[model samples]
Target: MELRNRSAFHEYFFETTYVAGIVLVGTEVKSLRAGKVSFNDAYCQFHKGELYVKNLHISDYAFGTTQRHEPTQERKLLLKKKELRKLEAKIKEKGYTIVPLKIFFNDRNLAKIEIGLGKGKKLYDKRETIKKRDVERDLKRYVK
Candidate 1:
């Protein structure tokens, strides 16, 4: 299956449970099925005791006209109340965030989003991650 967006492992220090859900809107859902979505720079926020994803871009359906939904509008995330509370607690900690790891469809033909509770990485941390990946790649190439 094709994944819409994948969070960088090095950039995210931690990950929690994976949840699945359906997204609202007609044109938005159609656009998502077409893989016309981007999760980069997108994150979740708690508003009025509910979770909403912000900055996520779901391109307007090609056939949709001016009535099409906004590309960067906040999208609601469906999760149980218990899960929402847990996420809210975790987010209260310093430097913690919720990021969308991937968006895909399951066998039942429903759209699902995989979200991760993540911690931001510093500049040097990201550089180190790149360096380690390069070393691993070189080792694998040399082993052949």
Candidate 2:
């Protein structure tokens, strides 16, 4: 995995997920392979009937020329019409959001992002998750 939004799991309960292709420039792809990406504060939104991810940061490739792509540009996401419509419907629901969960390369060496339709978790729910994680960590240490 090139990048992950760990906060997404803690802040929201994912109800649906979709694997979408990201449009990228050459330098951006190189940066991804070098593990220089951040999904923090990233989100998906529809513009002119197309899905795009905003605030995703793919750092410039170190060896790139002056044509290096911007790190925080809005990138278009490739999804089928049916999936897009489904997501649009889900998003229209109350308290739901679309967020990028992780970025990775497929067998064809193309970049893809796994985005989720999630509902924001309550404060108590977040605390519960933290407690569960701590318990799991303790259990692992005990086992070892």
Candidate 3:
């Protein structure tokens, strides 16, 4: 199953994307397999030179024991040191942010997050995007 943060595109202009593995526990993995995830208000940030995703909610598994995983806990992202350093350097610049775009399992059945280096869009940019999307829809309808 794949879960996407649809709002990320509307809110940011992505420059580059990276696929990074996530550190998840047993219950969290089960929750992901069940497609119980929310990306609302989720973002990536560096803590002590390591990257972590915050506010990416993975609900507790229904059949879990008393000690269940927290729904909105911060989870570490696994990336190469070179990539991490590059991202950290870019983040130090102005207006650059790390946004989680989607979550999906790889061929090996490991959960991975696709993150993008993006700049937040302005209000006018968002309006233009909407107008363009509406025009595309109209064009497609006309073609059909």
- lDDT at 27, model 1: 88
Which digits, one per residue and each the tens of the lDDT, describe model 1 over residues 1-144? 556454556677766856758466768878887888887788889999989889988888999866689899888899998899999999999888888878877888778888889888999988998899899999999999
- Give all TM-scores, in the order shown: 0.89, 0.94, 0.97
Task: Give the poorly placed runs of model 3, Cα more than 4 Å off.
Answer: none
Q: Predictions ranked by lDDT, top down?
A: 3, 2, 1
lDDT of 3 by residue, 116-135 (tens): 99999999999999999999
Per-model clash counts, in order, read: 0, 0, 0
How high is the lDDT of residue 24 in model 1?
62
In candidate 1, residue 28 scores what lDDT?
A: 85
Tell me the lDDT of candidate 1: 0.82
- Worst 10 contiguous positions by lDDT, candidate 2: 1-10
**Deviation (Å) of 50 in candidate 1:** 1.0
| Candidate ranking (TM-score, best to worst) | 3, 2, 1
C-alpha RMSD of candidate 1: 1.9
Q: What would the C-alpha RMSD of candidate 2 be, to one decimal place?
A: 1.3
